[model samples]
Target chain A: MTRLLGWILRYGIAALFVVAAVFPLAWMAVAGFKAKTEVVATPFQFFPEVWRWDNYTQLLADESFLRSLGVTFAGAVLFAALSLTVNALGAYAFARLDFAFKRILWVVVITTMFIPGIAIMLTSFVVVTQLGMLDTLAVLVIPGAASGMQVFFLRQYYLGVPVALEEAAQLDGAGPWRIFTRIFVPLSKGAFVVVGATSFLAFWNAYVWPVLTITDPELFQVQQYLATFRSDRASEMGLLMAGSTLAALPVIVLFLIFQRQIIAGVRITGLK
Target chain B: MAVTTLRAPARDTRSRGRPAGRGRRRETKAALIMLAPLLILLGIFVIWPLLHAVYISFYTWSFYEAPVFVGLENYLTVLTDQEFVDSVVRGLAFTAMVVPAQVAVAFLFANLVKSVSRKTAAVLKVTIYIPAVISEVIAAIVFSLIYAYRGGILNWFLGLLGREDTAWLGETSTALPAVAVPAIWIGMGVASLIMLAGLLDIPEAYYECASLDGAGPWTKMFKITLPLMKNIILFLLVTGFAASLQFLVLPLIMTQGGPVDSTTLPNLFIFRHFTNDLYIGYSIAAALLLFAVLGAVSALIFRLVRSEKAVDG
Candidate 1:
């Protein structure tokens, strides 16, 4: 009887978790196809009585949605590429090269993780404005182009690479830059992809920074655009759900493809 | 521990170098070249803004007029402000609710998954972790539909239970909790994975020995699992607390700290003052205070974790 009770408890809790994790997202996707009348009807409908494609069609045809989508795509790609290159180089230096004040410099970099962006945002806003980056796409990518976490994470991975490979390259008269690009970068490809995907997801999902920095509607990223679109069309639940689905699709797809690397990345960086 | 082990051998090799000075200079030049982009960006954006935040906290400037020196006046005003105090309390309350709930739920799920087969565990982990990859903004929007009043899913469930539909996010009493639901749900995936990693790290022999000694499941869990998982628990708590304290995006989009400011986190409070009221200095002061609190809490967790490790050793 006790063993039976334990089996029930185990599966029961697992069932609850699966439901909680999947239901809201599944409902949102279902609701996007829901008709306007069905969405507001009392005694809520789980699946739409009549699946409507108008929400998706209308959102696709909308100028602002298209523009914001373009901006989001470009911004995420650019931010990921720029940050990966810069952070990988910095991480390589920390992991391999000898330098003055290396320990203190690394400490300084890690300390920035403790300084929450909210604390420095006001001044960051002022600095960006002074640099004439406000209301521009550069505001979305440039300020966050170098993350302390990315550097620390990549450095940890780079440190695990065998020094004999680099030593052999040095004996063959290869320079530091050549050794890093040929040996370190290629070996740490998995870490690079992890960092790149994370950076991309971060930029894609960004809300507050974009909202605070960009005033122009055309310049808005998908998330900022979605929030404002929701507020503007608050009464239209169908269209709003559609917008949320569209905004969430890219990251969802990315996560599905790269789930293993992402999970490994979290374990490595998060634990240490 | 891994960091020290990895760093030791690298240092040993460098210490026995032949052409030490010339090699060091070349390495330094290469390092500087590689690090230039990171340093320049950090200098302009991160480091400068951090210093400027401290500097601006002591002055009253609204961008239209020249800065006027206030010298602790902004700090005093922010400290005594009732709204600021309430925001901090609400933030702490949110953190209190989120951290424990997430840790417990995550722990439960991790333990449950461990009892299953390896193939089943892998599939379960992926499904549960999917929500965490979705952005906070998207998660909040998704939950808004779930919590919607008229045709909302929650109300629909309430109808089945013969209970009256409540405005989950529209009332003061329920607003904070409602906002917290999505935060906890989205957080469960990552937290569970961390906990699962910790659980899997334990040797199978420990459980087998416990079973031979006639320990029940509960005893094995509490006496063996929990004690061994303390470090992972500490990691989850610290990161969870810090993340909760900086909660902004969900609240910003969902309620705008609405229904009489009931869900106003300190970050949101600062956001409103800086953007809407244009009280830049005041907002910076409040933000600084929030940072100090987070720092202290983090330090406490670090010390606790370190001491626990020492005792284990």
Candidate 2:
């Protein structure tokens, strides 16, 4: 009886934690299909009386919403690509190269890793403004492209790549660039994919940075755009819920498709 | 070893007519090419901004106003401002709540998952990690609904248990903790994953030996698990603390530092001063102070970790 009780307690707690993690998101998705009035109705409408597609369909048709989504989508893609290239190249050099000031340069990168992004928020915006990159896609994608953590992770990965392969390629007269592209890039696809996928999710979900920087309605990120309607918490509440759902759907889908990499990405990017 | 041997001897024989300096120069050039883009971007975006933030913290600049160099006046203002002081204290309290809770939750979730069957653990891990992946705005939105007075999930569940409705975000006292709940929810998973990695990394043999010695689960954990995973636990605490220091999104979205500014944590204060109020110098000074505190704490932890390692090294 005691052992059975223990088993029950263990799994029960586990189940509770999982439910707590997922319950809010699941409700948001469900409430997206409910009428705005029905969302906050008496007896707590757990399910919609009539499923509504108007919220999503209307957002798809709305020019402002579409523009925001387009910026976010394109920004995420460009960020992932740019971040992957910059960090991967730096990592490759750090791992494999014999170069001048390598130690000093690497120390700089690692030290900057400890300086939290929030700490530098004001100055970064000032720098971007001075550079005339404000309200443009360049501000979103370019400034965040280079990452110390990514470079570090990829460098660690490259260190594990066999020197023998590179030596053989060297023997075959392949240049350093060719060897990197043909050999290291192909071999480190897992690491690169992990970085790229996380970068995409990060840019997609980014709320604070865009909120601070972007004022142009045309260039508003998806999350910032949705935040505007949140104060409109009138009868359009369900529609707002639907907007939140749509904003989060891609990441959820991405997580499901590449969960293994994404989970590894969490460890890769979350903590040192 | 084999590759180095073959390549090393073959290289000298193959390039006997050429000096090693030529190859060294080529490798250096290649490395420079590879590193240029990253270095340039980091210089502009990361390094220079940090320097400039410190530089601007000394000036008096606001929205539509020219920046005037005011020496150390901004720093003085940040130090004396009562609102800023209250926010920092609230932020510390929030950190105090979040850091320990995150470490505990991560420990609890990690150990539970570690004890389960592999398949079940995998499934549970994925679902439980959902909050970490979702955006802060969406999470905050869902949570706001959950805390809604009329039709909130929390109040509904409480009402089922015959409890009274509480204005969680609307009440001055409850607003901070209410805001902190989602912070823990969002941050705890990755900390758990780190802890899980640390847990899995322990040699199964150590636990087996402890079990053979009639060790209880708690005993085994304290004796075998905790001691081995000290570094990882320390890491999670410091990292989680740093993360919670930047607690802005939820408070910004959910409360707007409402109920008489009770939910205004440090980051929210800095953000408001920077963007909303556009007190650039004061905000930058406050941010730099925050940066200094973070740096000092991190440095202190490294010192602690290093000293601990000396005894155990």
Q: Indicate which candidate wins on lDDT.
A: 1
Q: Give the C-alpha miss distance for residue B310 in model 1, angstroms.
A: 10
* Model 2 lDDT, full chain set: 0.82
- Residue A99 in model 1: shift from native, Å? 1.5
Candidate 1 on A1-272: residue-level lDDT in tens?
Answer: 98899788877777788888888888878788987667656777788988999999999999989899998999999999999999999999998888998999897776675678888888888899999999988998999998887887778677667677777888988888999989877777678878899899889988889988988988988988878777887778888888888888888899889988877666555443
Report the C-alpha lDDT of model 2 over B67-137, residue by residue, as the tens digit.
89999998999999999999989988999889899899888988899877889899977887778888889
Model 2 clash tally?
0
Candidate 1, superposed: residue stretches over 4 Å from native? A1-8, B1-19, B299-313
Tell me candidate 2's fraction of native contacts, as a decimal between 0 and 1: 0.51
lDDT of 1 by residue, B1-313 (tens): 1111122223223322434788889999999999999989988899999999999899987888888999999999998999999999999999999999999988887888899768867778888888887888888887887787877878888889998888999999999999999899888888888788778879999999999999988899899999998888888988898888888988988899998999998889998888876558888999988897786677566556556655754
Q: TM-score for every candidate vs. truth?
A: 0.95, 0.92
Specify the highest-DockQ model's number. Answer: 1
**TM-score for chain A in each prediction:** 0.96, 0.93
Alpha-carbon DockQ of candidate 1: 0.53
List clashing residue pairs in candidate 2.
none
TM-score of predicted model 2?
0.92
